[model samples]
Target: MHSRFLRLAVAAGASLGGLAASQAATIGLMAPLSGPQALVGQDQVDGFMLALEQLGGKLGGQPASVLKEDDQLKPEIGQQIVRKFIDKDKVDAIVGLSFSNVLMGSLPRLAESGTVAIATNAGPSPLAGASCKPNVFSVAWQNDGAAEAMGKFAQDRGVKRVVLMAPNYQAGKDMLAGFKRFYKGEVVDEAYTQVNQPDYAAELAQLQSAKADAAFVFYPGGMGVNFVKQMSQAGLLPKLPLYSVFTVDGTTLPSLRDAAAGTISGAMWDAALDTPENKKFVAAFEAKYKRTPSEYAATAFDAANLLDTALRKLGGAAGDAKALAAAVKAAGSEFKSVRGPFRFNNNNLPVQNYYAFQAVKEGGKVVMKPLGTPLKEHADAYHAQCALKSLP
Candidate 1:
């Protein structure tokens, strides 16, 4: 983030890696800090801090200094934040973004800056395809990848005539289109609601009339919180099996409580996943944040760790953007990710397992339970479109 002054309080509580150290690595975090999406943005900041704490406040044996800023959910403002980080702040690397709309204005600048941009979330299709670059990588699943897994899972369950809904945006369309790519059943009903809309009653009624065997949605943040609540109150919560991608997550589950119970959603990782790395991460995150880690947090944690791996490889070769980019590309699998197996594809996207998790009661609290892997070691379809040469 560019607003180093505004976020002094946030950094004060975070582990200060190089406050007294001479050699320091600077990283900037840009996210929506002052808008309706602040909850998820704050989670992004917390996830990065948790990873920093685990590293003993250092990245690659050097004190890591972080600058935090809020983009206010505007693309133009996001562009300014990235330019400020690159030009004025002179960050060694950049991380933390939540939306493609915002990234669209900032990502190209990273390509030119030669700075490694490790995306914690929001892997837009263009970045994974024709616009792919060596300096850019994603620790999160591409927007379509998890949705593809969810769509396949629904088909495997023998469900037919699935209804689909998402916000009328690039990511939303990408999610639904990704689902349709793998779903074998007919999409008897499909709808795109206004972004950040408060109520989904009209959409729910249409879904009920469509008589689909199941439904999949892609609401995120506050929209997810409101949509699930409205769905439960409409009494359609029991009418048909519901499935989703990015609709029900750790960020939204607490608000959903019993409403999201029994709902199945596809994700790259869940808190209950069976992996040594995931076990440690979930335990540490819960201890630090006092809340269960969501896939969003897991990805952001992995993003920071990924930078740690690359920066560590650079060791004394700090500030060498080209060399750093190469190291970051090669160090893709250096750290054990909470998602278990994570590696960069030809387009710098992750190729990993996607799981179907069902919301269920655990000790009187709603939690996501891993059902099964819908797609194992899955790679994005756009990887082939990327013309980047293989990394050495």
Candidate 2:
């Protein structure tokens, strides 16, 4: 009986010691890795890994494990992937979603589990507004936020009659609405094409017939590349003053080359953003990838750093949902973002700067140059609709 009691006491002590130690953290990144947007997804993954590598493969001195899964850019597949991460892999955190449709499918599951989800790319309006949750945060700006900047730019540039185009989707609708919200100009034509549609010849024909002073577009990923090249081929490149959001990006711009030149676009991050954090991030990314980092990759990089900061504050409490939410909010309050200063609004969206940039030719190459700041310390328009009792 004495020997048995001693053995039991030793076992109990070992269990208590294990409990006191911090557990290994797992972060599951879900993005479209096998579809048309594979390049975009890979960029996000690369950005995230770059940050993690710089941090010495650890988040706040705790061992970290990453589980990456492809959503295939399908909503159902994305939902399944996220569910598997939560139920089977038991990831402590969730990050990365390239498309808003995939984000929409994953949000409900994230809300149910109350796990911290830092959106690296997609920032749909619903998540920023009525459907906002405590655990869901966006390292990227709201989808409309950048569009609003473009709208303000057009309005300032004296564009009176502008044509707008996007894919027929939730983010597409949000982007157009955000553009119209600030443009205060006549929309001569509006077009919503099917997503991933290779041919924009028909849309270009309609635009060629229209009498718009300028045009704005919100195509992203492969769609942006296809549209820009097709529009250029259709004899609309330099002729029409084309402004876009998320269209003329690093992922698309290289493919576009001269076709993307003279195009004005708005984004939260550009290589020319004057800041030490941005310079360091840009240098590291270019050195690592041998190319410029897109806004999607920049945001994903920020998400990793932001998660690291929050996990450090949480310490051993990283697994605690309520505590983790507070830590995330605190981490976002004031962070050295690659894009510059980053603050979290009440809706868990970023309040950051937006710049109007034009694609220009330099040294026999096309590059984006910042023209001016359209939006400063910008927050989403739908934050008031986010009615969450949980506050950090």
Candidate 3:
């Protein structure tokens, strides 16, 4: 009777272990899902969900659950959502921390709890530098990277005097700083408008009066659409030479369309990239959603792949934050990114190529044609300031 009881106990323990090993991961995905940024958030959600569906509704060969939250473009709301995910939902990981400000507001809790958070959109300068957290990873480019590319392109193209404009926010400041870093020419005027201000008449008038050879700006989502449209209406687009970053990409292209023609922008990835992985992703995305995937979508898609590879390395155990972070670092080197070349810097931000693109009429449609690569295998300016020592 004792021997029979011992055999039953051992069998029960083994079954429980198997169940634990096969447990599904839970991911909390936060984004600005309403107001001006709704489309941006939808693209992120769609891209991630598409990747999840393609991966057989599993991450790392185990079923996964994704809890979606809308930050509404507010930092306070974002922090609350993060707290709920960590405290109430007990999520294994968090993705899509929205824009830079929201991400900044939520970072303290994420760092304190050692929760592995991946920012598919925001890569704030502070996080990339001295305040870098080992558990936080940004699958997207540093906020400055694309703007730096445009600045370098403008400099190379002999655009000596330029006006700089952007929404007054963390990303806006970072974008202007990045542009100045590479462009050594004179800045005619630096104008910062309110976030989602809807109108750019005053800024456009100021820009026109500056008489700068070109204009450089960083406006994403609806701001990009509105700004570019207003610029076109003011007859400054094709005539004045506009150079921008994150202002003429897939996210705003549909709205801007021909109005954005002749605009030159810089970014890490575009649908025009001639890579097999990118082609497949773009095709699948358009087929499923009937729209071109934005850079946000591409980054979030890559985030899903990165998470899959990481969880697979840990045999689906995402509960262990330190172990999961290590796995994510290892996976970064292993996963084949949809973006041409991608790897993580020691600061856990991306090291990738930045390209210059010209939006022009091709086949009677406005397309972002690849002009050149201004920065290759580029690491962020703040990476050197990071103190995390483990990653190579």
Candidate whose TM-score is highest: 3
Candidate 1 lDDT over residue span 296-321, tens digit each: 78887887787778767866345677
Better by lDDT, candidate 3 or 1: 3
Model 2 lDDT at residue 23 = 34
User: Candidate 1, residue 141: CA error in Å?
Assistant: 1.1
What's model 1's TM-score?
A: 0.93
TM-scores of the candidates in the order shown: 0.93, 0.92, 0.93
lDDT of 2 by residue, 68-136 (tens): 777777888878777776776555667886588888987888899986778888789999899999988
- What's the best-to-worst order under TM-score? 3, 1, 2
Which candidate number maximizes lDDT? 3
How many steric clashes between backbone atoms does each model show? Answer: 2, 0, 0
**Candidate 2 versus the native: TM-score?**
0.92
Model 3 lDDT, residue 14, Cα: 7
Clashing pairs in 3: none
